[model samples]
Target chain A: MIALVQQDGPLRIEITEGVIEPLPFAIPTFQDESGTAGAIADEISRVIAADLSGTGLFREIPSTSFISSVTNFSAPVAYPDWKAVNAQALITGAVTESGGQITVKFRVYDVFSGAELGQGIQIVGTTAGIRRIAHKVADTVYSRITGETGYFDSRVVFVSETGPKNARSKRLAVMDYDGANVTYLTDSQSLVLAPRFSGSGDRLLYTSYETGQPQIYVMDVGTAERRALGTGGGNMAFSPRFTPDGQGLIFSLEQGGNSDIYRMDLQGGGLQQLTNSPAIETAPSFSPDGTQIVFESDRSGSQQLYIMGAGGGEPQRISFGPGRYGTPVWSPRGDLIAFTKQNEGRFHIGVMRTDGSEERLLTASFLDEGPTWAPNGRVIMFTRESQGSDGAAGLYSVDISGRNLRRVPTPDSASDPSWGPLQN
Target chain B: MKKITIAVMLVSALALTACSKNRFNGQDGTAGAGTIQPGSANDPSSPAYFNQTIGDRVLFAVDQSTLSAEAQSVLTQQATWLSNNPAYSAIVEGHADEQGTREYNVALGARRASAVQSFLIERGVAPNRLKTVSYGKERPLAVCSEESCYAQNRRAVTVLTSAAGS
Candidate 1:
């Protein structure tokens, strides 16, 4: 039955099932004789190779398999030697330490084309920044080839869950975009949900039931202090998100009995209602330009996504495919909106153009929702919860092309992820 | 049958009173009291008796916001009991079945609580006497992954506080 159902889903299945050529590349360890600088350099190369190889976009040639030493940064042409090992691309770099600071320089060459694709130099405060430097180099190479920004330097904020399912304790946690350096941002005993980063990655807006009511609160990511926004008495307010400009917030406010979308100034007072309909309107996200917004509402009787002007204009329905859609987050590029769709008893994380055309569901499982774009918009991170016994939720990231599915390490079960922009 | 009729009459009266916005103005000013325990006022064998005890929480299907008929019946009985005890102002805690996104589930939980709140109001309970909060899927009543457990986790719970007591 599942096979029969899969046969009818979409046209991409046929294209995805076909054989395709994998990009072959070679990464040589940095030549730095002795000590921590050399060790860090080698690890950086390894991580960069792993990041690229894991994307399924590149096939890395083992260092042991290489026919050439690539040790000298100023070495002459060795295209023939690289080609002998079936390498299409070659990356070589070196590391140096001076004045208690480290500098790493790397270069990418298209062995097949016999031309340098890109080169980069990074200076780090400590050995730990070597990995970040490596990531930046990888981003540079990736963007040069794909014509899209890389997402490796960003971070994600999500709800970390522990304890029994019925009485789970949840805290807001943040981690590097590649799922390293996990840190807890809030220690509230009450539940925290739907965290979103300001464009600067310094402040976050999320909903907390700490006061016995669901209210929107903004917290400094570094200080952990928070202040409530708006005055809606005790009515429910949730799904808080910041405007791209960081000057305002868009969220859902439940008043009287109806839930509607509203936007308020981040610094203070007055509230402006965006959607005055009787339908449940929540999960509002702003476009990169801040002139438009995308959110999920049940105005059509079932939860679907809609896009509208930032100032509350006519909204155009963007989701028409099977199942219900919710949690629509606009990409920082302003070109796509990532959302969660529930269809045929299964959930999926998908992205569609701003107008909702060409919808592509990236990951499908018992449950997958709350997709937040990596700062550069090349990847999406979302929570995937398994079903039945042993059921648990964890963070997962996939390229926008629907490749490189990998689990992000978290201290506990995580959900409702929101990715912050690249650190300055 | 006699007991069922009496319970239905009480529910109808409460539902009627809920529709009027100012219905709480004439009641014992202590309508906000929150100390009424569930299942304490009826025969122990009666379904309504569960209202006086810590009532069981209802579970929901994945990504669903609508209450099942059984859950609605539970809420109806809860509303009827709240009407009978005027001193008990209750908070409806909405919860999800653990199958959707946290934010959406929070919203879904709210919709569930709102659905129950509107139902109770339509059945004549005062709006001020009832408040709603959504826990999304954060607070579950059951921990298992089976349908039996999931059903119990998706629920709108009536938490009676001391504020309603006169």
Candidate 2:
């Protein structure tokens, strides 16, 4: 909870319970400044409401319960009417469309203090980008109220699956963080797995068996143009991730029946071998600072999480739990690493400190793997395959606290989710 | 299971003798009648015959890549088949029961395939004739969720292809 002092009045305080009790907010349908705005204004308002409500931090006051509605964009705030309904925050917006360009202007108000939290701003984009405008508005409102950067503006890249358990077809698909506006980046001609976004979100790194073997590929997200990373032939590659700077790739390559981690410079096209051992070493992820790499290995006899210097040196084992741990992803905040644990015939999604202490399992199921962090590091999303022969894979998201576990709706079976950073 | 294996062996032996009888089958007309007996494990045209009759796969225990006595028996047979079939190379595709993380399962699958490869090499199969690929849990042999199906799914299958160098 955060306490905000009224900027318009003298020392009047208001408490915003962002987590305990969701702050009550109302978003009246945006006014269409031009008749050509069509239904985009209402659609944008709905997306904004959905984004805020999905966070579990805001309770939307239905339009029917509203005591008052603002029909004009420049109208004054009726604080008493909103306060009567126990609404703590109010959002107002207007949309205009001209020459195929759409502009959305919005303002957030503290209903109790009757103060505009900040100056209203207008964002313009193509009409096709109206959803992004809505997300921008929600991001602004969320940031202003909670004092935290909003993740609504981010995107997710995941594996879209179809067909049966024996012969499933998978392709790379990208969508908004809320699972809207999905666009397929690859066809199902070849099997694809674990699509990860570069820090800039302009490119994707994933494993593909298009050439009759598993190999890593980097694709431009916009153009869908892709090229495979050179593995010098007679070697198999998978489990690829980008460095924080997005200038390098760290991945696992198997040659002569031995799997080890390696790093490749995206520009220089040179490979740096990271780990050398007879045991299997895969699933390498870099620390937030790129100073160290955490990966899974069977070098210690069972699959365990380990950390080593980025330049590849003596590795220290981190996880000492009973189960085998793999798919370790360092959180953006650098304090925690999320992984999938298999124990006693059950799979779990869990988090632990960098030192391997305070290990907490957030989810347990028949299968849950491939954990990816939200841009804000407050949430984690992973693939959860249902139990049974008819069971299908689905994408699920959970807050770091393990509350608010929700399935992200997808058109078909989804897996290998990798949430991209917030778009610029 | 023992009866089924014996029945399959008897049927294959009968088919091998029938196919050995000289007849010009258009499928392999380029070769002489007895050059390619495209039946049973001895037939070059029927990889399925080798897969089913000669046993192209070895199953493993859950989460254990170390070959059991039964898996070793199967691999011994596979090694013998590979030794006799010198024109073919085998790609060992390792698969797991759908029970673990994708990345770890891939590594586990690799270990399983490598185990099979190493065992075959020790059994006199040429190392250069063997390659390994792990499909992880992505491809399952059986769709059922029970142990009966998972046992079949946790396997390393030796798929034979014509040796590129040969």
Candidate 3:
């Protein structure tokens, strides 16, 4: 039955099965129903094309090569003209601005079948948040064709770094998934790292040196108001990830030079020690179901991944490879754990099954660590730093298939990205 | 009778807070902060003397927190100097080279700092005069990416301050 559908199908790329080659698509310049939004319409069209093309699953056919122009969004698509240009998908849109609000309506068409894949959508957002509007439109288009959730309508919290390596200053920052509208949450007076968002994307958990030691700090993403978490600030705590329930946090707490994974109640002020070995145990994350946790430990004499019951039990070692693994974040899909591996003086971003099989390294760099999952669980964003005195860190994303590696644009050097859940 | 019990409870809580303050020099205001003479590097009992004559920092091997003979020797002197100067407290800053990831390097630096804290305690320096903070590879003393710079960057520096409570 599947083969029958594909044989006479409207062009579709199986993102999970893997696209052998990028599917060719064309998106004409969006029409501006309101003459005042002509430039905005063109920009929205360009952004949508770029978003699809950036996935590496779609190759956008340039407007210069288009045989038929989409001067009217409601007009019937010319199938033969699109076929002549070898375009598999066609998208047309229109943008209108009234008062202080802007509206964008778009439709995705399977050029071969000459039919709209889904009902048209008109997204409404403020003029100040025009980029978000474009992302939403692209998300609709992407989901209509790929039959999967879109990651375009998302945000990432990262640490923006500046100054020389020896005296680098860092601030907590958040940006759009493509690195737009960067807003700094904290100034660079004190160093901050590893900002992980809550389940609802309304709050963040990160490590800050505000009290003269690395302590977990919780922040309201909207108001930027933050306070020290009750995880024993003087004892030194870092690497905190919110529990699946978002009512508590799982993090590493250091005492007398030894570190261990722990979970704490965000409201009741109860602390649970999850790991109690003399060896370093840090970077704990819970599976989506919240029954088990995946963490990295050096109890085996070198860093390796381990899985244990969330309530604390004898952990089973899951990473047996030759390299050291740290920062193991359980994928949202619950089947894989993404990690940072260091071996032979080089670093990598890799993923493996929960049972520790079918390991695949997605990126190798001089310094790369801290993997954060996109909402869809198909993409991973991590920090990549260069080598030498002038070394700088930047955020990069790679799909689960290990294709489409692209640097996330930022106004300054950024690292330790925590991709937030899809926005409402 | 209930009022009397409440008064006793408040008194005991005040006493406990006072006892906690004894752990650090001058923590209860400026008890010992004034007498620790602000002498230059020449004064035998001054923090400057301890920093210059006795090394202020000790280096470690890559990813290793175990102290070397050289690092141990320097730390031994530091322990004695800390014992001699009761009014000054030290913050041991543990650091790692840029060869490791951020979170792991932080753990490694903590181990180095803790090692120093243990050695100092063993050599008769009061635990109350010492605190530890790990910067991981965030703050490096040497800027280059070579081994020489990494060797220097992987270190534990004992910074002194008067009336320190942390």
Q: What share of the true interface contacts does each candidate keep?
A: 0.35, 0.39, 0.48
Candidate 2: Cα lDDT at A326: 91
Alpha-carbon DockQ of candidate 2: 0.20
Per-residue accuracy of model 1 over A40-157 as CA lDDT, tens digit each: 7788788788777765566788878878787687676498888899777678887777655777777777676677765455545556566677777777766665555666666788
Q: Report iRMS values in order.
A: 15.8, 14.4, 12.5
Candidates sorted on lDDT, descending: 3, 2, 1
What candidate 3 gets wrong by more than 4 Å, as runs, is A1-7, A17-19, B1-42, B164-166
Selected candidate, larger lDDT, 1 vs 2: 2
List, for all models, the DockQ compared with the true complex: 0.17, 0.20, 0.24
lDDT (Cα, tens digit) per residue for candidate 3, span A327-397: 99999889999999998888999999999999999998888989999998989999999989899999999
Between candidates 1 and 3, the DockQ winner: 3
Candidate 2: residue pairs that collide: none
Alpha carbon lDDT of residue A357, candidate 1? 95
Query: By DockQ, highest first, what's the ranking?
Result: 3, 2, 1
Q: What shift in Å separates residue B108 of candidate 3 from its native position after superposition?
A: 1.5
Q: Given candidate 2, what's the lDDT at residue A172?
A: 87
Judged by lDDT, which candidate is best? 3
Worst 10 residues of 3 chain A by lDDT: A1-10
Candidate closest to the true structure, highest DockQ: 3
Q: What is the lDDT of residue A74 in candidate 3?
A: 83
Predicted candidate 3, C-alpha RMSD: 8.0
